[model samples]
Target: MAANWMRRTFVAAACASAALLTACGSSSVDSAISPDRFVVFGDGLADQGQLGTSFTVNDGSVNNWTSQLAARYDVKLTPASKGGWNYAYGNARISQSPDAAGNASTPTVVKQIDTFLAANKFADNDMVVISAGVSDVIANTMAFINGTITQDQLMANATQAGADLAAQVTRVINAGAKHVVVTGTFDLGRTPWAKQIDKEQLLTQVMLALNNRLKIDINPLGGKQVLYIDAAYQVNLFQGNPGAYGFQNSDTAICTSVDAGAGIGTGNNRVNSALCTPNTLLPNADPIRYVFSDNVYLTPEANRRLGEYARDIIVLQW
Candidate 1:
């Protein structure tokens, strides 16, 4: 009953807000806007070795989408710990503690932004990027699977987390940020984890509960200076038609780097993309032919394509 209500609410909100938000389709490239720096904040998808390795096959290439996007502008994205602009960390959520990996010290996206705002100011040429909420979904869904929370409670938590992420994006926009790119959680239902647990439908609802709420909340800003990337839509495209994207396999993971501890919030001893690399790939598995590196993250080829897709959207919009 609650799930149906939330779905109906999202459908209504999405329809009403579609005209106000940026379109999630092909766009012509525009080179009018040039950014001097890209201030990134989020979780494993955007992480660049803040935890010593990315949440994908770290093969000295731009494996993460944020880094892939930065490469298009020739802007190198390194971890802030190493005196660079990328503040994303593995397992980090929007504003929650005890990250998906059960680590309490992992800085949330809110803290990442706070860390930047504490000392530095935004420039007109600065492009602030926020890609998050996947970790929150993973954590909350795992809790429900463990009998720690009911389904309704999980949905409520996802909705609240979406609201929280929206507030953080508003914070960045209000902080004099000229260009902002916001991407909420992608569809975790298509992930290997969902397939493994046979909960694809349930996970799809959980993801929509968060992303749709976020899209609705941010649409009132009138689509100026801020762009929301429909990551779930894009992921669906590539995953559904892997052959068109030069991928032979979209459902299976390429790397087999299982972690001994809580990896990606699923549980201990699950495949962790953080530990993935070229050396850890399964037999006869080619990284370029696969879309996922583990149960939760993308392969290098997929990341590159997604980054280019996002770059096109930014160019066309701004």
Candidate 2:
């Protein structure tokens, strides 16, 4: 298998053994990662679904928070640019292909870029939004806590993951992308899966470290086209003030299944995650208050709130 950029970025990030600094390199191309108000019609435009549209057709997804958020900003997206009109690719990751446990077969970010390069060069209006490193970090951090590796070793690995993500962003910038929004890693430690206290805090610190390092390295040197979404910090805020965001269950999951965890191994499948998708909730359980749909994923409502949170940051910073 081609080495995922997450792992590859690790090596580049920790180039100096003693100093431990990130090696963020921008692409040689002049295209910046800033946005312009122009439309881009790619070969995959018809199939590439909209950013705010949900995958489900039954829930009246057209009125979901994503659509509302985009509407609030006057962003008009045609059918070819919005939701799949069927199902969304929730399984997509930042660097790698589909999650190890998902039913998706989309190419990884690295491959996605390569394909994009083959057909088009990112233009000024091309606001490329990139997000990854969470899944890789989650899997690796779990492995380390399970005694598979030491903490320092885990940091080193995370550094590379951060680097790979930066490298991908840089690649786009070099290819003439003027606008790019890179969502940083989330605080996986506080997620429902980190049921333990002490251990969870340590992992959360690691996640922060990775994001900070990415900002240290991947942030544009003299260019202002790139903006980062501090996803972890925002999520932490949401977890703390669930009611402020109209959520009732902040720390637990609303979706779960008894057979979900059957024969679970080490992957992120529903079985290992013990997640269920049934909409049925106990009389006292409110999905609106829940932060997660499963052990790692967010509930659709949470997703909307998170989108609004990020939008605030984007409007302020971008």
Maximum-TM-score candidate: 1
lDDT (tens digit, per residue) of candidate 2 on 149-178: 888888877776677777877877788877
Error at 272, model 2, angstroms: 8.5
TM-score of each: 0.91, 0.68
Question: Once model 1 is optimally superposed onto the true structure by TM-score, how far is the C-alpha of residue 74 displaced, in angstroms?
Answer: 2.1
On a 0 to 100 scale, what is the lDDT of residue 18 in model 1?
A: 34
lDDT of each residue in 1-318, candidate 1, tens digit only: 997699658644643343122224323345577788989999988888886898889898878888877877878878998999999988999899999878999999999999999999999998888999899999999999999999999999999889989998899889998888999888999988899999899889998999888888887874678888777876776688777667888899888998999988889998988888788999988898898899988888877777777776676556
Off by over 4 Å in 2: 1-106, 145-147, 196-198, 257-284
Pairing residues by index, what is the TM-score of model 2?
0.68
What is the C-alpha local distance difference test score of candidate 2?
0.50
